[model samples]
Target chain A: MSAPSQDLLARMALTFEAQQFLYAEARLLDTQNYKAWLELVTDDIHYWAPVVESRERRHRAGHYVAAADESAYFDDTRATLGMRVARLGFPGAWAEVPPSRMTRLISNVEVGEQGAEDIPVRSCFYLFRSRLETEEDSYHGVREDVLRRVDGELRLARRKIIFAQSVLTARSITTFL
Target chain B: MTFDVSRLVDLENGLIDRRIFSDAEIYDAEMDRIFRRTWLALGHESEIAETNDFFTTWMGADPVIVSRTAQGIKVMLNMCRHRGGTVCRVDRGNAKLFLCPYHGWSYNPDGTLKVVPGLEADYRHGIDPTQWGLLEAPRVATYKGLIFASWNPEVEPLEEFLGDARFYLDCLLDRVEGGTELVGGMRRWIIPTNWKHAAENFVGDSYHAAATHASIMRVPGLEGAGGRVKDVVGYQAALDNGHGVGMWMASEDNARGGYGHLAGIDDYLKSIQDQLVAKLGELRATRLTPVHATIFPNFSIEFPFASLHIWHPRGPLKTEVRDLTIVDKAMPAEMKDMLRRHCMLRQGPAGTWEQDDMDNWSQTTYSSLSPTARGLMANYQMGMGHEHTRDDIPGRIDNKSSDINQRNMYARWAELMAMDPPPPQVPAACRSHSGEISR
Candidate 1:
């Protein structure tokens, strides 16, 4: 591939903007402003995090396999996620009663254009959570997303989350990653 | 105060001696008495479709290997016979040999001794590899598609043990033609809570759903559409041999209608209703919707959604849970996929409904650890002694909200614990009130 010209360099500048946007999204989660966080997603957003099998090395085929059709931790459309957020607001959503103290570190942004307005971006994340009287629960994963630039704002259209731990030690993912 | 098995539970009253939730001695006794003798669920047969395929899990605290060999399916202790190390560390896979990472001891898929590092040079008199095969469970049986094993060779037949619970179990497992296939990987996690808490809840705690899972029923815009939520209209059965099944439905078609949350259960079951009717008759086909049954100690299956989990007792105050989404083999892969997604969101390890449950269970377990709280007894007085049997459902059934299911489970638990005889003696100082320790 030829080196990027000045125009390509300018387009790549969007990478910095994308990183800033993710940081802001993380801040929303950390501050427990999940209601507002919904604004960052498109109306038709599809978020999924498939369950990972703990297979033997020989059976793994030398790579990690996460099937989209299989059971998952989170597979929410815009409506489902909205309900989920609304549920979190309910006093009966006891899992978030003493809402989990969360810190999401997003890094390693790799971005490319999907269409004129949609950008497919991939990044790694380390999510740390602390619940009532518990030390901490750490969850790390890779998130693949398609972000659409709607009216100069990047809105998540789709997300495919893959976690590092096939056998999760956390009691629950009380907070969004 | 230490464990006093005799007072661990009050046999006469319906009070569960809270110490049983955190006692080391009672936990130890249970490992030998109840867990060893009872039929515990391991995995579905469909999980290991091909020969050499295996699914690893726990039967209580002991790690067990369920593998399919050329001969047949084998359920054996995952511990190495040579040095007691884990023979197979992986969860599920196709493997030719069970190799122990510690001492390089390998066994065939059937757990027969294959190669032991340097067998030829190590001993002058050759050791008998024949006597060194993996310790297999004495009794292993399957009904519908769910496989269960018992450590006691003399235990009752799995069918006989399951008894009336079979009728309801068939509603889920036997619904599919070629039986059920375990879709999706097992979701395994740990919780600091007694296994009994989870087991007893599934045993029959239907009342908790209304207040505990209100959010699930009243999803955002669809608040009063109510999904599958209904008034207390179903029954709970304390089946033969300690097993219990709690069932609730809104008529026939609307029974499991709220399972997937996407396609609604009526639409999903409509295609399979004929098959279910042919297999289970009209009443069972439509009536048995949302079923949650626990096979005694820790095996639980949630129906329509088709999620099965085992609460493997880690200690008196800790548990390791492993779950999987199962679907009928004859169903289209897409529908199975949908059920898989539904089960995940509804009750997977980090599920919306499940997360709420973890909060209560974990907190209760933590509170019970305090010395001041260990002696208190939990009540099981919902519908004891006064529950009536239903005409359609088999076994002694009660209203969905009644605590009879929980009471009957403790009755069975008391029976099983009595079988082991109060551990010979309890420390004199640990004794408290009559049949209970009041710290």
Candidate 2:
């Protein structure tokens, strides 16, 4: 009926479409189809998980791992991610050989601001991941994503995860969360 | 029955009887002796450097709140005296006072009871606030920003507790001007193994590095760096107080030379070398390169990598491990970021190295629970007769990578377990409005 209403409906449709793309990406991870999952990311994508501490600006006050000083977990280019994937596929990636079955439950989808190129985009995710080997194995965190539309196909330009639990229960994080 | 302590003395020769790991009675004795008496590492001083800052953790099975007060740092029992309710809930934060959720009782960060809800009108004279503050741990002390507390008052002083291990620690901690700081947030995970397994792994288990992390070494560009998956050249320093450090020497064939073989270790280590040579002479500086050690029961610091401190809280059949990693305050931002990534990738709940270790640890616990596996013992016979007293070094330095550190740990465990129960301290005299109660 009205031009403004029509524009609002069209925008909503694009947002929903972007949300569906994220859900599909999560499904690929849950199924351990990392090859298909890699196809969803841009070539120069940054996957970072910054360690959040109790105190502000005090670098060493809260970290609990040897490598906490310098890098984010999974800080890598496409090349590094490929190397990790290759290691997983290797016959002796002992950590993942008898791969722990996982389920990545992503929810609370909401579309956010569009990027510079007017790439139809959104950001919203809560990933609750669990490995089937043990009762105490689980990880749940929120992800802030930047999606870019290339040739009418949505792809992840960047993803930053912030974990809710200060103390993790999983024995080892062999799979992506 | 012929009496012989030799069977129990396998620990002296760096040979641990596997029974100590799976025995219910030994674990129970350890709770009474080791956990109850020793000055357990609670948290770092930096965790609560400012007043009102607090961190909640467990000392053995007893929940504890380590807080910074106007007076100083205070480690108190987390349980409220009134109704056993936890005074602080969140993992950590800055709070002036802690108010119990079950009841409205409140306590200052110093652990003094400050308020009781709705009490003035009803039996005001009977309720004395002074007697109801959170219970203070018997002893609290710090060594180079590392905080430790003891439940038993009769336990030895902190310096004496550290004993010979202090000499080795000075090589790492004292080398830096302000000492090292913990970076980012702690990467904690629950490994299904007993605490001893994790402690021994870090203490003197360079022997397993090559095999456990073979894939990490296989990474192409990383092969040149001496940080690869090989045990290489290393020496184990076993101290008098059951503490020990393993120093891995750089391979002689490496073109770069010395500790330089490690990845991203150039600047900070060079500074450490300069400081160590200034303080402890060239020989000690060279010998102390690549030092990683466990402080008694569970606290371990790996110079150049990160500090690891584990708290072992045991149930009848399970052990909960709380581990923290420490990085240097002076480290470059990029290095700190790389170290954190490396930590998560290798040791966190989802690290490559941790995966193999956890599987073994869990299986060990599971198999130990089986009926048929009840009396069987895990072997620790490596380097049994091969170890000898070295005149040049201070502590017992084992020539090869061996299970001597684990044996030393169990020996200390047995010593603590066999010690006489410490005498209880006199309770503070209770004061009532009517009069003071002597009881």
Candidate 3:
């Protein structure tokens, strides 16, 4: 509504860079270059997507109530993910069999509070994945990431994914967010 | 393709009609004869610890409310007495009464009709207020902490139905001194496959592990507690009333074995060994190894993952798989956390081994409906007539590699289906607070 300020423009430029980094990460996943993608992750990363509860809108609005200390779809450390990523390469991994043809649509990127060690960013994602001939599965969700600068590069330290689809259509959730 | 329900299974010859997987008529009949009549697991007792505490779950496609009543736990249909609209829409909450949004008719946790907005002014016939209440499950019972209900009032007692399966169930439920508590909310999802595919797999099919989940076996540091996959020796127990259990550890003859390779697991288990013996005696406490099981119709449990399953049938071709994790009440926070992680990693919605099982099941459900496949029969002949009974151990025992569990379940299924029972008949209004179902 008003003339653009200098600090605001600088922050916009930083957010654009963060978006580019996320796009590059998505590109690596699309190409199935998991080994290279692993380098972009922090040594201590916590990737979590909790099992959501379908509750009344009286308190927590539709499917918003998630884990306190419960079972999650994913509650993985860097070491755990390393093994999982390694498993994707195996031929017997049926969920990944015929190799998923997928694309990540990442949008609404907004960099939130910046701490001394970490910068939090929020964005929404729609992962459209197809397998074999025509069995397609679409997953839409929001991701909150706490990224940190490591060796002059952004690395994910923590990621929490919240899905819009309460009843997952896919038979298996093997692909990453 | 048409199928006679009577000929769906031939356990004497170890043959199962492929039509059972995809036939619409048989699935509908199953809902009548089996699901409606048999005891269905609803939720755990710890869920509704406080008065008015409630949890909503499914017994098949029907929505059920398991509430902690002033008297005890009550299982009632979620439908309102007024226009049959869903009254308690929330998944779970602590509610004093369930008020119908359509007409504001409220019922207590015990299914008693508590409130009727402007009732005396509206009615001319002087309809008794007691006649209007929630439609509750005819029979509700709890074994350990698991709550189950059956529409058929004449159904066998829960303990009698569970029978020998209780010996193995105790291995999971009664392991620690205080027993286990559900570790938070459930992991519920829909899989496009017949419910029986998931049920039978958990009931009997350990043979798939070495082949189906071969990739998961290669995960580093996942020898899985006492080398479960490494030492692939165990026994499959074929229990009565279609319930069966498989214990997959080397030589389950004794109660003492490696507690697993986890740093604190061995010490924790060793600490509880004496208490476990005191609580459940030596044979039951030690003999039941951590493993996979099913309590006929739809309920399943995996002891190794500390998880439970209810394969609710959505239709002949779809299933809603609700998975939950349970941890010992007395376990340390860190151990509970690890068990949750382990449950998620191994058997939850995005689990390692379950992914493969889902794939096989998806294909089986879709392909079995073909004309050629429908005419053909699926085989369960691996050690078909080799089922043996152990006097020391309960129920019929068989080699882990055998199809005895599957045979036992199908035989029970055919036997039940032959009864040809009617679908449940619930009253128009609420049931009384005293656990009575009016005609």
Candidate 4:
């Protein structure tokens, strides 16, 4: 076989870069460094996690489930995201008062076409949270994200989380997925 | 399966036994006494706007299908009559027929049996379709656009059951001429807490906001700005039939759905202020701004968020929190979507204000399981003697942060629990088109 083309090598390098950026984000969230994680997102971030429902294949075209503009778990902008981070700092925020120990496992990184300012990346995440001795929750989902370059650093512009469960088993989703 | 209701729920002394929170036998009794008798809000009219549109939900432990036919809305048990399998397994769809997966038994949108696989060959067409139809709720009614159904045919009319609470419910539902519609789908999550905790919390537990949602107060415009957090100034109305509402004193800033922060919504409500006054009368239109309310057993409304919550009891120790966001039909599309999105910042499973609530609720349920904690009675003495009827208000009025409403709720709960279950009537589905039994 002939040597790999330069374009192919550049694509591979970009994919590696995108994978590393996501891994760093996972680390920040797992370590409960929400302030630092907030820094890695762009000023105009749109983080959304729409509610999913179980429906038959024939009902796919109908409003059997949440559509793009429908109900969601987290529909956060930059300002609202900052408020969530601010809430985590308060002692009276009882959900996280004892502070859940979390571990984020991210894999299956895939990079899309190189845009002028942003690159689309897809990854799977398994977020495990354990709190108060025995209470534990695990959320597994795929993240469709747009990573853009801002001030010579990669930052998250948009993230759309799609979960596997129809009904959330966890009581409250205080931490970001 | 009989227990002492007076011992479990003692509202006279403003005391409630811990056993009621985690008792298995009491939970089963509630399924029969409360869920089967009271009017349960299943879905909104907009959810099943067109004919054959449907959604599956739970009425207590029973799975139910809420569907719309050409005639009207029909609520029926989702189980198949033949082998007790669910005819409709999906969450929602527009289906003309629901075919049971276990067997090929099809049901019409109105819950009449449409077909059986071996109708011609097996038993030589012995089965009468009407007689073998799905079991349906005998009493179905709608207040505004919210559809409610009761299993007991002898149950009171919807308006009579609602009584004085309709005045407050209208503040949320009848604001616009076109009425309200849910914004897309629903959010459901499970929490380890008794369902009553959620219902009573909405009834008159604004006092918990200071400690439970202290973090939300720091957010801009939620409570107050510049370090002057607004104190709770509201009236708790303990109405008949166990319904309760908590309304904050209305102000010019709050006519915009209670928060002065939502400038866009405020301006929109202002443009139609005169129409509101005309529709709801001057006082109700301008003065009563309901913060939170519960229509007895489980259905709850949060006005500022424009959302409805159904605290479905999973067991004695767990609850399924199902929620829907409501919006005015006359509002502009952008404003409707904005209102839905704005509510997400403060409610739902991930909402800042509600996130802390689950911790409190679950812990309260869990701590009640301890042997040491079981011996003690929970306190409900706050603002007890302050309950009095106000001429302006329509119910037993109490201080905004009073436990009078809680006591009122428990009193009704005990009254219902002590009564015998209503005898089952012939299901409406078993009757022919002329309202006669098909047999």
Most DockQ-accurate candidate: 4
TM-score to native of every candidate shown: 0.89, 0.85, 0.94, 0.94
Fraction of the reference Cα-Cα interface contacts (below 8 Å) that each candidate reproduces: 0.68, 0.44, 0.73, 0.76
- Tens digit per residue, CA lDDT, model 1, B148-173: 88877778888898888888888877
Model 1 steric clash pairs:
B257-B265
User: What is the lDDT, from 0 to 100, of the residue B12 in candidate 1?
Assistant: 58
Provide per-model DockQ scores. Answer: 0.57, 0.37, 0.73, 0.76
lDDT of 4 by residue, B1-439 (tens): 6678988877878999888888889998888888888898887999989999999998887789999999899999998988788898788878989999887999999999998999889859887777788888998899999999998888999999999999889887897789999998888888889999999998888789899988877766444211101332588999899989988665545443434566476677777788889888776776667788899999998887788999988999989888899998888988888878777777777888888988898888988899899889999888877889977779899888889788888888999899987665555544346442221
Residue-level lDDT of model 2, residues B1-439, one tens digit each, is: 1212246446544444455555566666566667777888877887787888888887776788999998888998887878779887666778888889897889999999988886787657677778778888878999887889988887899999998787767765666566766654565656666667767777777787666666666664322232322335667877776787877544434422344444566655565667667776655555435456788776776655564656465553455555455666666777666565545455555555566667666666666667666555567767666666666456777854777766777677667766754543324543344342111
Choose 1 or 3, whichever is better by lDDT: 3
Grade the docking of candidate 1. Answer: medium
iRMS per model, in Å, is 2.2, 3.8, 1.4, 1.2
Chain B of candidate 2 achieves a TM-score of 0.86
Q: Which ten residues in a row have the lowest lDDT in candidate 3 chain A?
A: A59-68
What DockQ does candidate 1 score? Answer: 0.57
| Cα shift from native, residue B374, model 1 (Å) | 2.0
Q: Provide the clash count, candidate 4.
A: 0
Cα error of candidate 2 at position A151, Å: 5.4
Write candidate 4's Cα lDDT for A75-161 as tens digits.
888988998899888888899989999999999999999799999999999999999989888888889999999977899999999
